[model samples]
Target: MCGKRIDHAEWRLTKSIVDIERLRAVAAKHNVKIPDDEEDYYRHLLNGLDATAQQVADLPEYEDPRLQIEPETLPRQWFKQKPNPLNGWSHRAEIKLPSPKDKRLDNRTVAFKDNVSIGGVPLTGGTTPEILTGKSEYPVPKIDAVVVKRVLEAAGTVSGSANCEHLSMSPLSFTSFTGPIHNPWARGYTTGGSSSGCAALVGINQVKEWRKRHGLPPIDEELGEGVDMAIGGDQGGSIRLPSAYAGIYGMKPTHGLVPYSGILSLFPMIDHTGPMTTNLEDLATLLGVVAGYDGIDPRCTPETPLREKVPDYSAQLASFKQTKQAAGEWTTSAAGKGLRIGVITESLAVPNLSPEIFKVIQEAISQFESIGASVSHISIPEHLLGPSIWTIATRAGIASLGMRNMPPPLLCYPCPDITPPALSQSSFDILDRHNPASANMVFNATLLQERPDGASLAAKAMMHVHELRAAYDRALTEVDVLITPVITRMHSQHPSLDAKVEDKMKPAIGSTLNTCQFNVTGHPALSMPAGWGKAEDGDAKMPVAMQIIGKRFDEESVIKAAAAWEVGGLGLDKWDGR
Candidate 1:
């Protein structure tokens, strides 16, 4: 479309589909008023443009450099089963790493969210294939997501794709067409979603580990081999919510810390992908591999560290462990002496915060003193406005871009092979019929676009994100990290597929209120398993989670703080009902 960037003849090319009658049809389609008298004048102009489009389409396409790999490297197959037992895996694979020198992740298994691309693998995106092609065939990506490539380069084995929410929109596991992802701790209950399968896969592995450590035999529900770690996408708490619900560790790194290239973007501003694992070391190790600038993602700002400059999170945690052990403080009160942890007062007041989880997190935060860390209550009033700002700022963009199959205006590699079908009323109804949130998001977008002052409000909200970021940066100066409960409540059982829209969406209310703030502010946030709480439906226990927020790009401090607490404060085992 850039006339100056191409041959002149492409723009000047003659005669096309529309002469006069066809032109009238086009104008009518767009509801444009064109004078009948001027039809001939406009006809020639439109023909030139149409010819130029054809000429540009005829030119050789530029291939993105990232896809160039050894031939036959991606030996692939389609998943025969629709929804597996845990309903966690979208595809199953046993991909080995290329000859990695460091071998940091040798023999470790990693699960990628279904939204992430892995060459030659069918990407369900947690929705049915019929929506896109009107056939059974799903789109198979030929490019590996940046994180997927990194994991393979580090000697990790790709376990397969983890099921996610439909359209990557819902925060409940129940919405995926693949079916409800069972909680590892309690079946039939949700492992909070969008990154539903990631959490379930990692969470199940943790449960297995606990059972093995206790010398207990595996139960029927503990049959499958889940992944050692996962790479999950987060726009508004997708990664953290599932991790929290599943009783594992998930970190949404400071925006752009991980290159989001090759992944289907939800919203460029809030889009993020990061590690979710059973423990800190794995989380740290995997993050270290993926946390560097790819130079293409718009989110990877100038502030992003280069690949070599990216901290070795595993090495950093190792050093902390060494220093503590050598000082005879490995499991003693001296471990967190220099750490400053702040509890955000406004965060606790977020509506829908469960009394059960709120109390557990309070008790957990108070235990920081036992490990010699200072836990102070910090007030950031702007935190309360984050949900509203994030909504007004992103709802329109997320809808229009997603619905019409338009990419954002960011400079990044384009996935050429995949073609998203334009949403027809039938397709829209198909999606809206299953998930109320999907309809709500699109309706909200239309509501905003139709309002005379809606764009103005969105613009102002975007501007204020900077203000919110600065407020947090100032608070972070006085504290190493800020802490809060992961959200207003814990994940609940799946609502029936035939349930009313209100009933289907009831559990997701306020789920993202606390988590979405960091997505907008671009701060790194970690969701760590805090403790076990009784499920609303029964006496069986489910995991409770707490949020740890850090200054942008400072993932090392956040990881170390979690490690310090697990090692010297209330142990993760104690939190897990050990």
Candidate 2:
């Protein structure tokens, strides 16, 4: 009777022999009915009790323990998470010489971004599932990407590939599906990316297991006791952003300064690959190995040399050290004399900027003023200030080309005929809410349209492009270099999983606003780590970065200015765990 419900008639029959007599008395007081027939009444009572017990057991409080614990603390006995396809060896193999007479790069170990293909290693490009399935296909590359072949020939050995932004699309390292690129300076904050892995390996300590396998020294040993450098690519700040976040020096070089063949293409018009490293000398040395013109890359000019035949970067390093040693005292009037620095007002006016970043920029200007350099705030044309229509046009062109060129099976994965199930599902989700016929109607209209023969839309777009380039050239007239924040906002605080695509996109658009336009206009730009600031995590300080933009092909001038900043004691002293 324990406050249970049962049918009535059976209770009276069961009263003569069983505990139903007590049950009936309780039920009668509550005006409840019980089933008839002694056995039937008893069975009904049991069923009622069983049903109540089942409901209680089904309550949230009685659910499985596995779902209740934090993922980090979950038992190892549970199934392990899938290993990231993008992970690879962190150190380089010793370069075995073809002959004793062949020159070597003095035992320097070079690691390449995963997107760059090495003969046998998996080129995952962060999340190209096709590579993992043994079904991946690539046309016979006409030649090693000019940079890859050049680096190898220069006595650099390929270490294992490093992770990158998925498809190298985003500037934030965390957007990488393999893992968030951890900041070497601070463990909790993000390493700037799509060159995330390239920065991480150079910036942070390598895993002990990898060090043992490659017979290479640990990161602490390498940075503190030896030297190592990372070579990576940039499209819209990939190389520069990571270098800034990792607190290292990086150079994007002039557009087409390094050949782009055999590298994964993001936007060819804006993409440039270059070096990332802790020391300026290391960057110079690495760049010397990889920079060259390749006939395969249409953008590469034959005039560009494979290596700048300078006396040695060590000499430049020594000079920089000497300058730092001079402190506030100037040895000569030439110190910063005639140096013109322009601050782009449009870059500063972008919204959501952390006050600390602004402070760093202001402090840098004061430093320049303390010396003999002239600093002024300048405005770029409103239309040319941020990334413009060209950005979208280039990206669309690349994507369309990639899709059209992909092998039939690769394009239609998981179905190989018709559209892929996975792809169709995702596509329909975007199309479902809209009228299905609208897409076809728009396509047909565009196909059927006729317009005036001359002064066509394409011609108009070309004119706009020229106008923008002219505007940028004019803006640089009064300034030796334009200065702007590396990113509009501070580095994100949460782990990679917490960030959304839009979160990465917003900052990328802002940061690349000042950098990418230069690429379209064929100017050179360098991003230097200016300082650091408190991250949202309140544990590690994220890097504060600034960009120095120079006129087209003026790589040497941009390099010299960046050198000045590094020599001026603006570079980070240590990025080891903040």
Query: Which candidate number maximizes TM-score?
Result: 1
**Residue-by-residue lDDT tens digits, candidate 1, 1-578:** 33444344553454456777889988998899799888876776676677679888998766566754335355555554343678888888767655764688988999999988887778887777776445578887767888887888888888889989888998888988878888888789988889999998888888888768767788644436688999999999999999988889999999988999888777889999999999889999999988899877888999899999999999999998898889887675767878999999999998877888887788778667788898899999999999898999999998877544467897777554445565668767767667668768888998998899988989999999999999899999999999988857765788888888888888888899889999999999999977777776666777788899999989989988888887643334664453
Best by lDDT: 1
Residue lDDT tens for model 2, 350-458: 6666787787777666666655677888877653433654553344433433222232221111111111112244333222221122122223233423344322543
Report the backbone clash tally of model 1: 1
Model 1 TM: 0.93
Candidate-wise lDDT, in order: 0.82, 0.56
| Candidate 2 lDDT trough over 10 residues, lowest sum | 411-420
